[model samples]
Target chain A: MTMNKLQKSERFSVVKKILIIITSLFAGFATGVFGGGGGMIIVPILTGLYGLQQTKAHATAIATIFPLCLVSVIFYLTHGGWEWKSGLVVTAGVVVGGIVGALAMKKIPAKWLQPIFYILMIVGGIKMLAQ
Target chain B: MQYLWYIIAGLIGGVIGGMGMGGGTLLIPILTIFLGVEQVEAQLTNLISFLPMAIVAVIIHAKNKRIDFKAMLWVSVPALVTACVGAYFAPRVKSEWLSKGFGAFLTLLGVAMIIKIIVQKIKSKRRANK
Candidate 1:
């Protein structure tokens, strides 16, 4: 009898282990620097390393960012960096934009998305270099 | 072995981000190309990672009295709200289009930055000559 492919418990186990390692390192250090790139890394890692579906990877990435942002926000607040009014506005916009972006992501083709994302990276990089 | 790479990446990312240069620029490319991660995943990772860095920067700026609560409030509230909206809608949208749109945004931002820098340099030179 062919081993039940769905019952391949080893796959899930491996995925879990990889996820834990990636999440911890990506979230932890990236948080410390107050930067992004972890999101970029997470999705790819989830799909490549953990073999998750692209959609699932994307969802997971979004979920992970929430807590990370929350913690950073808290840290800023404690440091008296919480600009209530501005934070509120940006947060508002981000929340709205984020939702829209997320919704849009589901329908987009990965192939099309990749080039655009890459272009964005190059442009963003050039901008930084200029600065 | 990987820990070393992680530390290095983090350090570089931190310095660039702390300087307000946008770590996503570096992180995204590296993740996609070097790390062999998918583009969407890399972008998501960058977005998620940015939260903490942004928050920290905000805090540092606040401590330095450079936060400009008034300005920050204006910028952040809208940003936050939109971010949520974006996130909520992300699942439904086409990733390819989103990627293209995001790329256009980045390119525009880059061009703007370049122009700004050039203008600043020119103005500084004029002032020095005067």
Candidate 2:
């Protein structure tokens, strides 16, 4: 889609706002308790529940992460569990990776991406268990 | 049916995030594979949702004095700037390649984490043996 088309769709209706808010809250809570996974719920909620198109939903998701990361970083810092040097390094990596990943998102096809994503999840889950 | 999945996703995500792992590692895949969300949508959604939670967590951590503001400044400044750049460019990339790339990255990271844990455990054991 062209930039104009994407821009036009960016504006949210009342219902969309409500849905986004509700979804964002749920996502927030999940992130707090799980350490990550808000986006898993956010995307589906946006697409399935809120009716946003795929790319737009993704863009919106990135917009939302800023607040969440800020909150978590603060909490970690205050709690004394965070390693500043490590967090800085990781965050730096995430930023760079995130940009690259985002740019890549616009070029990749959904079909190939979805299955591979699923496989990674299953493997990750199993790995978590092993850990 | 869908709501059920959302609930499940929320629960799983919460647990994972609470533990300090990346929920995106799991969430993106579930959305794309089972829920039929596109890769871009799923990833963005994960990033977006992370915003509030990270903020809250940071607040709590900050109050408890866990935050490293000096370090955070370095990390967050770049993170914020890059995130915007990422968001702006994401949609132009094709979906499949992004998915594959993300998936591969996650897999490698997971494996590396596991390996690190094992190595740590062995090193500890050897230390104890001595």
Query: How do the predictions measure up, each by TM-score?
Result: 0.46, 0.51
Error of 1 at B106 (Å): 2.3
User: Which CAPRI quality tier does the interface of model 2 achieve?
Assistant: incorrect
lDDT (Cα) of model 2: 0.50
- Predict model 1's lDDT versus the native: 0.45
Candidate 1 segments whose C-alpha is farther than 4 A from its true place? A1-131, B1-8, B54-56
Write the residue-wise lDDT of candidate 1 on A21-106 in tens digits: 64556443443232243355444545655566654554444344445445443443333333233223323334343334434545
lDDT, candidate 2, B77-99, per-residue tens:
33344333344434445676556
lDDT top scorer: 2
Kindly provide the TM-score obtained by chain B of candidate 1 when compared with the true chain B.
0.74
DockQ of each: 0.05, 0.05
